[model samples]
Target: MSGRRGEAGSALVEVTWLAILLLVPLVYVVVGVFEVQRAAFASTAAARAAGRAFVLAADPAEAQQRARAAAAVAMSDQGVDGGAVVIGCRPACLVPGSVVEVQVSYQVPLPFLPDALGRQAPSIRVHAEHTVPYGSFREDRS
Candidate 1:
């Protein structure tokens, strides 16, 4: 009876400790995963939006400007910083039947990590590429 009484509270204490130990890591992992997912979403949307903007622009200079602006907006909407957007065109840009490829890339810092860690901190890089085709019958602005 004395032994049972002593063991009664031991199980509760053990469980509480175990829960605290397990839950902290579990919560950290979940937050990291969510942040990476958000970055992925932002990159994908940025690439798609930038590609479309590039193809719709009236001039080469405007196309580049619009592509960057569109990509920045898309990334910002997902709570990510304005990332890099690189555009490449097939043969010639703003030409009929040409295809424009836009790539969006950014790094997702680990959950609860500070920038002071610099490159030493673990981070996940997310990249997305989208291609838009200028209509065959459209006027060539190149």
Candidate 2:
């Protein structure tokens, strides 16, 4: 009877330890998901701003410059100015009445968890792009 009692206690201890071990990974996954979501929002905003800038630009080169500046402003607003946001032309992309592509990219840092789980913090880079028609109505006109 004593031997059985001892075994039961050991089993409970093992279960508790296992639960604690699992909790770390669970928490990490939840936090990481939220961080990724925040980054996605930032990227989307940057892309939209870039697209708007391009649409307002007078020429291709000016469009590119505007795109970059717009993305920078968006990034700054989102508290992610340190991250990179790139704007590029797609072929003969900036013709009047054509579609202009704006790309926004950034690296998101995942905070470190405990080393007992043998997991290292991860930094993931994400990108978002948007295309807007060149002839769309401008804000100033409205």
Candidate 3:
């Protein structure tokens, strides 16, 4: 009976060790997935907002400024960096029926990863694009 009593705690110790090793990694993966999803959502929203803002502007110069501002605001609202926005415009963007395109990109860092391994760990890049067409009623002031 004495010999059996000492070995009883051994199973509990083994189980605890296994749980720690598995659960920690599982939690990290879940958090990383959530971060990626957030980046995707932010990028999409930023592109849409930028395109719409550009089409509604009074002139070409104002359109560019407004698009950038709108994209920045949209990304920031979702806790993403707004500096990565890229706007692409079709020829004669202010002309009637012209198209305005906006693209937003974000790099999502891995959760609980060391900065030193940043190069080794592949960062997820999320990108979204939206195109808006100018109204047919737009007047050609030039």
Candidate 4:
């Protein structure tokens, strides 16, 4: 009977330790996944906003500037920073019926990671692309 009681106590302790060991990594993974998802959303918003800004601008130079600004705003709104916003035009930029493609890409660092891990800490890449077409009836001074 005494042996049984001791066994129960040790079993409880072992189980607790096991649970803690298992739980920590799970929590880490969940937090990392959430961060990656947030960055993904930020990138998506940046791409869409950039494409719209490009389409609305009067000329190529202004279009590029507006697109970058819009992309930065969108990413910053979600607490993300330093992502690339690239604009590519199809069939000539600013012309009626031209298509502009905006791409936003960034790296999301994993949670609970240390810089000592490497110069490039473990990270997830969040990327998004959006396309906006210049309105067929849209005419502006350039």
Q: Evaluated with TM-score, which candidate comes out highest?
A: 1
Instruction: For residues 1-142, write the lDDT of model 1, one tens digit per residue.
Output: 8768767768889999999999999999999999999999999999999999898889999999999999999999999997888999998999999999998889888988766745667788999999999989999999
TM value for model 2: 0.65
Question: 86 in model 4: Cα distance from truth in Å?
Answer: 0.7
- TM-scores for all candidates: the values are 0.93, 0.65, 0.86, 0.90
The candidate that wins on lDDT is 1
What's the best-to-worst order under TM-score? 1, 4, 3, 2
* lDDT of every predicted structure (CA atoms): 0.91, 0.74, 0.82, 0.87
- Model 4, total clashes: 0
Residue-wise C-alpha lDDT for candidate 2, range 1-142, written one tens digit per residue: 8768757668888999999999989998998888777788888988998888877777767777888888877877867755565655444555544566777778787756444467655578888988777663433221
Q: Give me the runs in candidate 3 sitting further than 4 Å from their true place.
A: 117-122
Give per-residue CA lDDT, model 4, range 59-86, as digits (tens). 8898899999999999999999879888
Root mean square deviation (Cα) for candidate 4: 1.7
Q: Please list the residue runs of candidate 4 whose C-alpha ends up more than 4 Å from where it truly belongs after superposition.
A: 140-142
Q: Give the count of colliding residue pairs in each prediction.
A: 0, 0, 0, 0
- Candidate 3 C-alpha RMSD relative to the actual structure: 2.3
Global CA lDDT of candidate 2, please? Answer: 0.74
TM-score of 1: 0.93
